[model samples]
Target: MNLINKKVTHKRFGMGSIVKQNDSIVEINFATDNKKFVYPDVFGEHLELHDASIAHSLHQIIQEKVLEQKEEEMKKEEEIKLQRKYQELRLGHEKLMRNHKLHPESQMVFWCDAEEQNSSLSEWKIFSGEIKSGNNKGKPNKPIRLHQNSAVLLTAVEPGRPEEDRRILGVYMVKDGFIGKLCEDGYIPAHSEYRLQLTEQESDQMLFWNYYVNEKFPQKQTWNTGKYRYFDNSWMAQILRDIVALKNDTREQEQAQQFFDHHCKMNQLIEQDLPKPNGSLMRA
Candidate 1:
């Protein structure tokens, strides 16, 4: 790395020997007079080193710098692209809200098994709750209220905790025109189009009781003995907004917002009409 006393040739100075080298600065004694130049920068264009080994090392360093610069530029470009897409999605959602054409019905919250959900989340990417009664008993239960574009919030009682300690596990949009099919013990998709699974830490932060406590039965959880129930769009909207706030990374936030906007547009609601992130939903 030291270039003291090394012979080098310059386009203007004719011939020179490095006299002092300090960090990036190099002073050389030339036939005409003393000259100073930035070390590797001069070597890149205006000068050439007499030592081949040192020249090779400088070449490698220059290559590395070029590569790093390119990578940083690419990263910036990607971030800009993501921002533009996020803005476009927001604009589209706002336009839909103004028109009132985005009506989504049949939204519900279902009780999901933690173990089965964990597996499906990683592998099948499907969900189903069992139907215990009626003509379709022993099959995967799809509520009559569920439809395409409907949002579903999945919940499970926290492991090692009482039923009162139930937590939300995931949120999903039922796939348009999807027919029920079996996956393990239940059905496919609930007919899902978009799905977002909460990490274990995230699940812990969102308790089911905190969001949907029964007012009449204050001591009871929202669903005491049901597979699922029709959920209000207003409540769902508020939950989606909170999910967006839960993300710390910019891309993650964008993704959450994307899902929020999709759900809002499908459900014929605007962000302003709903409660703010983490705000309580009003019950009638």
Candidate 2:
């Protein structure tokens, strides 16, 4: 915006006409002498344009800049909070690693069939299981294979893209015995722990093939056909480690905090407290 030759008023300088204008500075010709001031900065506080239309336009621009600055500050504060949470969680995870070992008495990896890339990563409140062999075979069933309080690492493969690589989506811990009913929706755990869901960026880095491959045929990925596969403590530990590494390498603090919050809860789990898998029946 050019202000050259425009009349202006300074609170102290009384009256003046803008003699020159530059990107950052504006000069004015006061009755007594010439004066210079910072552009825009002086308009709202130290000076005002004499023309009503131009003055209104400048006022709107100034208001917009102020609003943008406030938003930027708020964003910075939120990022700081996330960083603080991350540091606290990092310390907690270190203590857990030092004092405990992996427990997979019933831990398993679950694969969700999805078409959209982030379908499995959505705010999931229930998960469907498959009936291995029965009249209603391949239909949604309760998670009969999971023991109460066991950890389940969730993965996903887009439907019709079996040949493409899969991605690890999230993790969940089951609640006490079978709490779901025979409904079309799916099963619901009494509680989900370390309920971590990967962001799109995080999922890209956690390809299923990159972590778990067939032992005999190093080139082949495991869990080729099954919806769920039991994974031992070693596999569980590997997944946990990879998750921690991924969180540390990303700048998305809000997403990382969700993982850290639930991850710390995992430290409190005790193997003996978990119920043995007894193939309990779902509610009628």
Candidate 3:
């Protein structure tokens, strides 16, 4: 429109000298000694652009640039939001590990289900009980002992599966005061040998084992006995180290100490309530 460096009249500002012109906007110096920038498409009718073809071309370019800018800004905002969400998730994971008192140095056992009946990893449950003194020909052997606060590296045997890989189920810390005789509690069927119980929180966490499983130990290792057992060899050690660091960072050691202290107190109380050989109450 050759409006650049030309005198023109703005509908509102009145009688202004065009100082600059670009694809998107035109800047003008008003007679009142004020400066204003106007978008051509928005104020094209209000001002004069002598060349109609030039005005149309500039308008299209301006529209395109504006759309591009909006898209770029939106992308940046999304990136920022994603980064923030990740940080929150990391913090939440650390807090969870601490609350459970999970640590790498703690003694842990690898528990797995190999039976064809228990094919689904989601249905696996750990058992604890003493085996019957005499070997019952058809009965399943029960654990002789189980302890509260025990940690286990859990897994399910995967043989001929599509992935052909054993998955590492996340670590679990046994709940406090949940250990007892399977036969006495009646929590499960009489034939079932495990008496250990997990809290609702612990049970729900198990559902997300796929998310928690250590990815570093992708390959499966086998421990062969009468049957083939598959497990992630490095998963337990790696997860322990990671959780230990999380617990320390979250300052959960103090909470852990208090838990043990209370546990000891409860044990003492139980011992005191026990009857002596002579049938007298035992001293605390």
Over 4 Å off in model 2, which ranges?
Answer: 1-105, 115-128, 135-142, 158-164, 176-193, 215-218, 248-284
| Residue 253 lDDT in candidate 1 | 77
Residue range with the least summed lDDT across 10 consecutive positions in model 3? 275-284
Provide TM-scores for the models.
Answer: 0.52, 0.42, 0.34
> What is candidate 2's lDDT per residue for 71-157, written digit by digit as tens?
999999999999999999677656644544434434566666554224544554445666679698888866444443355677776
Using lDDT as the measure, what is the rank order of every candidate, best first?
A: 1, 2, 3
Give the whole-model CA lDDT for all candidates, comma-separated.
0.69, 0.62, 0.42
- Native-to-model Cα distance after best TM-score fit, residue 149 in candidate 3, in Å: 13
The weakest ten consecutive residues by lDDT in model 1 span 275-284
Instruction: State in Å the error of residue 218, model 3.
Output: 30
Q: Model 1, 44-94: lDDT tens per residue?
A: 689889999989998898788779989999999999999999999677656
Error of 2 at 252 (Å): 8.5
Worst 10 residues of 2 by lDDT: 275-284
C-alpha-based local distance difference test score of model 3? 0.42
